[model samples]
Target: MPVSTVSIPVGQWFTDDSGRWWFDSGSLALDFAYTGAIRVTVAPETLHAPDDLTGWMRERFPMPVGVARSRDLFDAVSLRDAIGRLALAAGRGEELRAADIDLVNLYAATPDIPPTLGGGSRQAGRSVQTVGQALSTIARDAVDCFGPANDGRVRICAGGCGIVYLDTSRAASRRWCSMQRCGNRAKVRAHRARKSGKVALTAA
Candidate 1:
């Protein structure tokens, strides 16, 4: 059976320590082709432009691929460090936390969701070795080298696709920076899934 499509807003992203836009990862449709593919035919950059958030709500969008890492492409320490401290705390190794390590952002370009190839259940996901030291370590090192606060937050400003970290403290209650979209979406998905059997795995 084919899975139905569910489209949402695109989120913003940040430039890693190396200064490359890792662009938001959650809502980005990696497979968004006109033929109805999970991966989108359009370029990721089309919806996302690093630090260039001139778009607006539902207008251009600023959502992540899914609700997972939002920027799982960080393959370096500097870039990892660039991820907010809360992100680092949540991220496993230099990547997203154990919960979202294997999840690929599944949000779509349109208002539809494509079939997830591997399915959304990440119960089997295993922890992977990080690049160099942990993100926290790298962040600390950078702070020391820079001799000041470079500010652990990245700037991603896509009106609707953006997330503003309300609190980046050490608490575990830090879900999405905003509750209107990401957080609300999660709640809705869980409810819908519980009410129906069609939902196998959801990254909304």
Candidate 2:
């Protein structure tokens, strides 16, 4: 079967920094790469097939979804879009509609798949939970991003990649979601433009 969608930076969503469990871009990363596929199409695409959804969940959240079905795909897509809407609104400092918040709240209440503990001889173990719970937690994280303390720090990427991130920089002047990705691309484009302008001046 043909793969429906793939991700850039393949499966690099969750960042383990100094033994802390958090995304590098704050909670916004929960919806960053996955959510954009809801409205816009990426080059490799996001979640187009059930397998894609399963893989994304497995890689990003480190959960086993087994075989993802059509229904699971739909639910995943829906949740992603809801989170994205909230992130955008938060970044813009616009009050979110009651319905939007309700959507996320509903999913946050119940988990589709429960977790189970597995891993041999590690001194301790935990069971794997359902995928539904994993996804719900992701939504909850997105909601947390809208909290007062972090909301003001939220920023929509200026690179036009349709990603939102928490600007934790001391100066609070961060403009891109990832300096290695979006930031570098923006700089390269600007450099090229400046060079082009210089050439035009020489010609004139």
lDDT of 2 by residue, 61-159 (tens): 544445678987777777777766766777777887777678777776775343344565752224454556656666556556565656478777787
Model 2: how far residue 201 lies from native, Å: 14
lDDT of 1 by residue, 28-114 (tens): 221111011212121223323322222221233222222112242222212322333323332222333432222211111112222
* lDDT of candidates 1 onward, in order: 0.29, 0.59
Question: Which candidate ranks first by TM-score, i.e. highest?
Answer: 2
Q: Estimate each model's TM-score.
A: 0.23, 0.64
Candidate 1 error regions (>4 Å): 1-92, 95-167, 197-204
Model 1 lDDT, full chain set: 0.29
Question: What stretches of model 2 exceed 4 Å from their correct place?
Answer: 1-24, 32-35, 38-45, 63-66, 111-126, 181-204
Top-lDDT structure, candidate number = 2
